[model samples]
Target: MDEKRSVRISKTLSRVLRHDPASIGITLDEAGWVPVQTLLTALGRKGTRITRDELDHVVAVNNKKRFAYSEDGSAIRASQGHSVAVDLGLAAAVPPAVLYHGTTGAHLDAIFREGLRPMSRQDVHLSADTETAVRVGSRHGRPVVLTVDAAALHAAGHEFRISANGVWLTDAVPPGHLGRLAR
Candidate 1:
């Protein structure tokens, strides 16, 4: 495939894996993988197609490096989540802290923009428990759990953020977060 077309495929695959395609203007869901029909439709919109062999070629060309292959080789997934997945994942981690969220969806965008990205996802994930999962949840007047000490973030430092649903955006919170927070 041409470099331009290859780049498009990579972007399309990333959108499929991370944000819901429908949310970004595309519509596709093939049971954890984009269905061939949906792929065809998208390709058609872009004026392209694969004659089975071409599909195999694309899969063979990018497998494991830029994407993953299903057991039967009938499906594929982005290697991580996007073209810049590694960079995002490898950035400094967030610290244990109180994460806030909007009880209503209206404040979701603000929470993410102001709370999530800037903070490490490993320090918080997002949750619906206030006074508990602090790392994940939000602060938009919603109940959320504030993880007292996320091991990952604790090891990393005190830089963190919150998820849309109020969950801490951490890699993983320790099991005894409740006790840790109490202290």
Candidate 2:
């Protein structure tokens, strides 16, 4: 699959698997998994026919590693970035001393005042490294990377969980735990 087709499929998968399974008439289970065939059928019904080969290809080469197949290879789900309510089943783990968030300057004043809120998503998504944070932030506009005091937050009893794709997930980053990093 070309990058364009792969990306299109990925966005579709991200939508149904993460944010809107009901939009395609499929129901994700408690853990946000749906049988792979069911998803293909649902997409087909919606006139976005993606083949199994294309699906597998997109899942394999997605740059962000956004989707995952179940251990038994019968089902699939988004690794993170869900706006809908579905527990990812990630456990609290000690994060490194620092984490990073990427955002546009338009949100900086609010972010500096309110810290990082999840916004539309379930948990605030953070990158384990600055490069990834820059890429994430650039998606919105000119990127600004914010340094997170992960260790201090963890010590203070804030929970941290690493996603399957290495994104750090947390309920919120209070202003005290945030620091300006770079534009």
Candidate 3:
């Protein structure tokens, strides 16, 4: 590839990985990492023809460290995709009042407090425990806390109900309230 051609691919890759290409009038989907077909199409439209071998070579040679291939190699994913995953499991039962999420402009905080109900049934994957709750919360820049005590919800006036194969029960708490219960 010529210097200018190589520069174009690099630029395209950066935008495609960092943000949805569709947002800027470039139509391409993140096929796991980078859709091979999309890359070829985009390149073709720009008067460049890229082969699968070239795609593989570009993926291999690029050293910016933002791209990754799925284990099955079906798709590609940018390291900076959308959310960050954190496991916030405090070994003991001492819960936190509020989970601190990402810094400024992290919109996940709102998602944690409101829950995913507004979106759709398919998006409603509530966090199962303090650990997962915090992670799910962090994805949007806010953390979540348990509403009731994990050890003694009944004693705390919560009716005991079990779902998730007898491990946990779901209940409601005040909006934006974080409970820090003792073990």
Q: What is the lDDT of residue 147 in candidate 1?
A: 35
How should the candidates be ordered by TM-score, best one leading?
Answer: 2, 1, 3
lDDT rank, highest first?
2, 1, 3
User: Measured by TM-score, how close is model 1 to the native structure?
Assistant: 0.36
Query: Please, what is the whole-model Cα lDDT of each candidate in the order they appear?
Result: 0.43, 0.92, 0.42
Pairs in steric clash, model 2: none
Choose the strongest candidate by lDDT: 2
State every prediction's TM-score relative to the real structure. 0.36, 0.98, 0.35
Give lDDT: candidate 2, residue 25: 99
Please give, for residues 1-183, the per-residue lDDT of candidate 3 as tens digits: 565666666556656544545443354342324455665676577666766666566666654344556567655554332222211121223222222221122433554466323131111222235565554455665443434332343335533232222123223332343343232
Q: Considering every candidate listed, which one attains the maximal TM-score?
A: 2
The Cα error of candidate 3 at residue 4, in Å, is: 5.5
C-alpha lDDT of residue 54 in model 2:
92
Cα deviation of 151, candidate 3, in Å: 29
For model 1, the run of ten residues with the poorest summed lDDT: 81-90
